[model samples]
Target: MELCFFDQVKAQPLWVQILLVVGTISILKFSFAVLNWVYVTFLRPGKNLKKYGSWALVTGPTDGIGKSFAFQLARKGLNLVLVGRNPDKLKEVSDGIQAKFGKVQIKSVVVDFSGDLTEGIRKIEEAIEGLDIGVLINNVGISYPYARFFHEVDEQLLKNLIQINVEGTTKVTQAVLPGMVKRKKGAIVNIGSGAAIVIPSDPLYAVYAATKAYIDQFSRCLYVEYKKSGIDVQCQVPLYVATKMASIKRSSFLVPSTDGYARAAMRWIGYEPRCTPYWPHSLLWALVHMLPEYAVDAWRLQFCLAVRKKGQLKDSRKKE
Candidate 1:
């Protein structure tokens, strides 16, 4: 049989033989990748979060992805430490969850990530003092109000972006890390952005992208540092979820609603150190990477310029 196959290949034209060999290898490689994606995305079982601990702490829990995560965690019977800047909003979210999951315990902490982060994180540490907080969702982050050139960014906005997105995440993780370290088992999920990962460049939202890039690297480092300690650290990169920050009010196939994104996100915790949770976003990420970086960069710049024009128009209308 081997001699017959060799004879058949020898009989074929040189180019045809080369094409067949390459085509078979390519098909097998592509098939394996597709199967792996399917298993990871759909077939793989999610970790039983309860095993991590009984309580989960989430930041920015008053709205958007944070809010959805809070509700979902409650649904899973995990007690909560809901942290947000506004006390009233925190109370409201806490009350809503308590109402639905009457048996679940809930605690609220007021933390303004932009103002006096030391105090903010102190509040978190204090609130979680006795709780077995197995999960820490560093979901609090800020983005540009709208797109603008790097030079067009104001001092206040720039300060807030760095303070809230970068420093805030770092401090909160520091406050929570010791407890998890002592317990020696926990999951930490830092919310990241496609601006830093999926796209070649986020032209007008430069600082926001940079901050998220820091988060990606930061999470990777912690993952390696803590894996042996039974702590799972991850950075979740999501693209264009329909949220107020994105200025996208309506959810669509590509733009998942906050709840949808959180649902997908929950499945990925304690797994990959870096991941795009929403499957559609993963598809988008893959497509973006296939294109030339230069082309993507140019397209991003033009898109941001248009966004800036529209934002400026809205500002003028408000003033008028």
Candidate 2:
């Protein structure tokens, strides 16, 4: 059999022999990648979160992904420190979680990311003092309300994008890092976006995409810096979830609800430094990368333009 295999390869033309070898290697690599993804996404058991600590702190916990994460963490029996801008909304979420997870302790911290972050971060530090906060979820972020040209972005809108998305995440992580470092056991999950990682560009939403790019790099660096310290840092990049931020009101197979996304996210913590937790989002990420960058850029630009046109029309009607 070995002799026959050698003879068959020797009999083939040079190009055919090269093609056969290349094809075999490609197939093996692809198969291995698929198996790895399947194991990580489904078969692998998640780390026992309580081992990191007894409490989890989540920013922007009043609504959307942050809110969903707060509830999920509570379900895991981890006490929660819920931070958000709105006191009333924070109370509402705290009450809701308390009603269901009666044994879980919940503390509410009001931090307006777009406002004075020094004070906001101080509040966070004060709230977590002397508590064993093992998990920190930097989920508070904002994006363009509607796609617009970079030049069309107003001064205030631009400021808020940088403030809330980039600066806010950075400061919150800073406030929590010392505690985790002292304990030498923690997990920090920063919510990122596909605009920065999966796609080549985000077209008109330039500032939002740029801020998320910062998050991706920040998480990667922290992951490397703290790996030996027994702290896990990750940046989770999701495509679109049915959230108010995305203006996606309904969930579909491709677009998970906030709850569904958070559940998937929980399984991925303390693992990869960067990931797309939702399985469908991973599929989309693969597809997007398979295409040429220019093709994806053109498609994204067109899509954003349509969204902007619709938003403009709605604004005009409201004014009239």
Q: Report the number of the highest-TM-score candidate.
A: 2
- Candidate 1, residue 130: the lDDT equals 80
1-320: candidate 2 lDDT, tens digit per residue: 99999999999999999999999999999999999999999998988999999999999898899999999999999999999999999999999999999999999988889898999999999999999999999999888889999999999999999999899999899999999999999999999999889999999999999999999999999999999999999999999999999999999999999999999999999999999999999999999889999999999999999999998998899999
TM-score of 2: 0.97
- CA lDDT, every model vs. true structure: 0.93, 0.95
Give the TM-score (vs. native) of candidate 1: 0.95
lDDT of 1 by residue, 1-320 (tens): 99999899989999989998999999999999999999999999889999889999999999999999999999989999988889999999988999999999998888888888888888888898988899999999889989998999999999999999999889988988898999999999999999998998899999999999999999999999999999999999999999999999999999999999999999999999999999999999989999999999999999999999999999999999
Clashing pairs in 1: none
Q: What overall lDDT, based on C-alpha atoms, would model 2 receive against the true structure? A: 0.95
